[model samples]
Target: MLFIQHLIRLLAQKRNLTLLTLGVLAIILFFGLRPKTWPNINHAEWSPDTQGLMFHAPGFAYVDDLHTLHDRASDQSFSICLAVSSAKQLPGFRPILMFHNGSDESQLTIAQWETSIIVMNGNDYSYRLKLPRISSGDILLDGKPRYLGITTGDVGTQLFDNGTLIAEKKGLRLDIPTNEKKLRLILGNSPYGNHSWEGTLHYLAIYDKQLAPEEMAASCQLNDGIDRKNPLLLFTFLEGKGTEVQDQSGNDQPLLLPSRPMALKQTFLAPPWPNFTLSKTLLADIIINFLGFIPLGAALYARLRLSEAFSRWYPARATMIISFWISLSIEMAQGWLPNRSSTLLDLVLNTLGAILGVLVIKMSWNTMENMLSHANSATDLAK
Candidate 1:
């Protein structure tokens, strides 16, 4: 009982209350901004080697990887860029990047058909464009390194080879519809056919917005500029010896290589908000926000009690105002984090929790006073 009385007296001091309040706030921020790991959809068993993702068209080998970035890139004007060194040029189709939107009925592919580059939108083969003269000449076909880039917008699609415009066709805009089904991104092969890329791929990048002509040229040169700043997904084959391709953009979408003739090699590489979703559980989120602010409310109440000139009703109003500002700050800061989300629901629940804490302290004031009075009486007896 004596220890309880002493602890209460210590918390009644303004400095002690302020320190405790700050400590609690620090703890809340640490957990709220920590890195999040998303659940993987599948795993591919493969041995580590050093060949850097080799695919065989005859054997129909490919890599199927799942990522969380489909919603961000889907239904947006985007750009795709990669560097490839072909071992043997095949007259048939060779897929470089293919994405399956859950059903075999829909897909987005960036491929090479004979000496031409192809961009297929949706499942319909009629919606695709075959850009002739894009991959011609000895630099691309004679087993040498060359950069390839493709940009798509509502206006049209543009294909670039080594910083130069090769061929472009209008009236074909690519977009993936928003649906409930999961999306899978494939590398080096298509899901339907045995059209696998037989080559060495150094890097691949996906952007949420169409790259300007100058930006596309800079990206093709492998130089650092705006191209490195705005990628939704980027993979640099610098892991050297693993089946996992590290996402250089830091979005946590690691690519899993299937049990094929795939490997990673060392390569010099260049580099590179919160949006709200209604999919989260309302009850669980409210409970968490409410619990997070309870300590702040208790601290505010204790501070208000130390003021001698305030009215009896001042503590409740002051606690509410202070809690509002604090919650607002947290939500605003969350906007800068890539994985964290800011919502009005969280703000309201936090304020409510603080108000509840103040009310609880107000109702128990007399009980605390009684305990302190008993402790004083015991101290007097000891004297």
Candidate 2:
């Protein structure tokens, strides 16, 4: 009863402060909740000059019906060959091509980190199993087009660049998605749609049997020596006018392109666990989050201090609690927005900002009280 009365008294006496607090909160919500992209097909299109699918922005092509790529593999041996060119050197991990088991289980992924090539193969249901991965040095992002190929055979997994063997690891088994599982093939973007590769894909071919050294060399040059019967999936992207890319390998697995470019999968309220990275963007984000909440902290502290019940550390603690709840609410709401990210890091930074605000207000109040006390003492001496 006393707490409610004190809040009412504070609001009634300090209407301007109340308005300021509400106004700040409104501004934060407005900017934080904005969507990233609207539904549009112009983000991706087929280029006649490049003779391939061009991704101008973040978009993807998906293959829903998995027919003969994984189940027909000869003794778990397969080769993936593709000719692609990057727009430029980009930061962070972006998936050029990937295969998953419908849901969240990733089977195989060909991702790019800066100018390096990363091939990850495993059933990543949980973080328990250490997936086998082979990485190469800065070989991508060159001016000319490059043929990237990966062949996993009885010996090991080998990474090929422009028909030449660049990196290889012996005794590593790569698990490709089988036909028994409801698999999904995504090209040019990640399943979650957060990571998208901007590039031009000239051609892609997957063989059931691992290509021999000579065969790999021939296929990298788009020669006619490739085993016609062994190709499980192939895409030339010759249809330079439609939303669907034809599969020339004859398995009838065509890539269906969506008209509206949006996130392929939905994620909600994801915690910031192991995705931590020290980058310029991350540092900038930290600064913004910390500074954004400082005003809220100051306003809360000032409002609470007007109450007689708020004494000593009470106002400061209340300010922090209020700030935490506000941050938590915003983060939770961000999960619903496709562009916004809900992270624990942001919440922590916001709380710290509020604490700093409270400290500043506390120091100012102490200095004012000391000055008033000294003035009263001088007046008493004059009397």
Candidate 3:
């Protein structure tokens, strides 16, 4: 009882209260500011004997300044062929390859959701034309390498697994932008560093002309499997050891294997609202975010109320406002950290937690006063 009284009395002092708040803030920063491990290049490896790029976790290699190829491929028929082996099946969409229009807008994306392969064709207006999205069945999770290929012409698009026709859609075509903007090719991860594929990349080749099923199948049989005829882009991953993957198509566009994943430069202040999905992980994140700020709210409210620095209602309001600023600052910082998402949901939850803390301290104020009084009486008696 005496120890509790002493602790409470110290917290009520202005200097001690400031120290306590700073301590709590420090703890929050420590957890939120730590760099993500999966985005590091250490998670990726080059297999010399197998001549493949193995990604133990989410990582990426990118090819930049592809304006010439982007312009030619736009409004034209094309085919893409790649061989990949899934290390483990995950629930969310994992991007294996994406083409961006020199900016955040995506021109094309080939991703894996669970064991299914999904191919989306469009520029920034993809969400409007939802159909023609090719979502294949669970075929890549068998723990063995499989060759996946796609061809898109003016009529429709077709997907092939090991050269076998699996899924095809009409009225869907490769819609690369005709603009002269620079283009980027991201392999193994999304541009935002969110969707990361865990697998081994055997080979990836891009052709200007849509190839027939026989050609696509025949290409998979060869060692490199590149069409050998003027491919727009080809990555064989045969470097064995280097920070760069040679572009065998003679495009002179090399894929750079950076030590860290790419993160958005200016989105730290204003990230788009996170898409909420119901899952255990989501539930846990909500709980952690809400409960984390409770102590700050309670301590600030208590100190403000005890010091009589503000009116009766203002202390609670002030506590909430202060909590909001703190949470927002933290969220902004998280945006720069790889793999750490800066979401409005977390900010709102943390503010609500602060409110809860304020209520808790308000309700327990009388009890704390009584305990302090008893401790004082006991101290007087001993003297």
Alpha carbon lDDT of each predicted model: 0.63, 0.75, 0.76
Per-residue lDDT of 1-383 in model 2, one digit per residue for the tens? 34444544454466667787788888777766665565535355787687778775556788886677545652488888888888866677777888876544446888777888888764232224555688797777674578888999789999899888998989775767665756778887766665668788888888877887777876765544556545778888878888799888888998888776555555655555445567897899899999999988988787787767888779899999989988898888776543357778898999999999889877866765666567668889999
Best by TM-score: 3
Q: After superposition, how far is residue 35 of candidate 1 from its true place, in Å?
A: 42
lDDT (tens digit, per residue) of candidate 1 on 68-112: 454564557888888766666665556767776555345677666
Which residues of candidate 3, in runs, are more than 4 Å off?
1-7, 38-42, 102-106, 122-131, 177-179, 225-227, 264-274, 306-309, 370-383
Off by over 4 Å in 2: 1-13, 36-42, 65-75, 102-106, 122-131, 178-181, 221-230, 259-261, 266-275, 304-318, 336-339, 369-383
Q: What digit string (tens of lDDT, one per residue) describes model 3 on residues 37-56?
A: 73355355686557578875
Model 2 / residue 346 / CA error / Å = 1.8
Top candidate, metric lDDT:
3
**Which residue pairs collide, candidate 1?**
53-263, 228-272
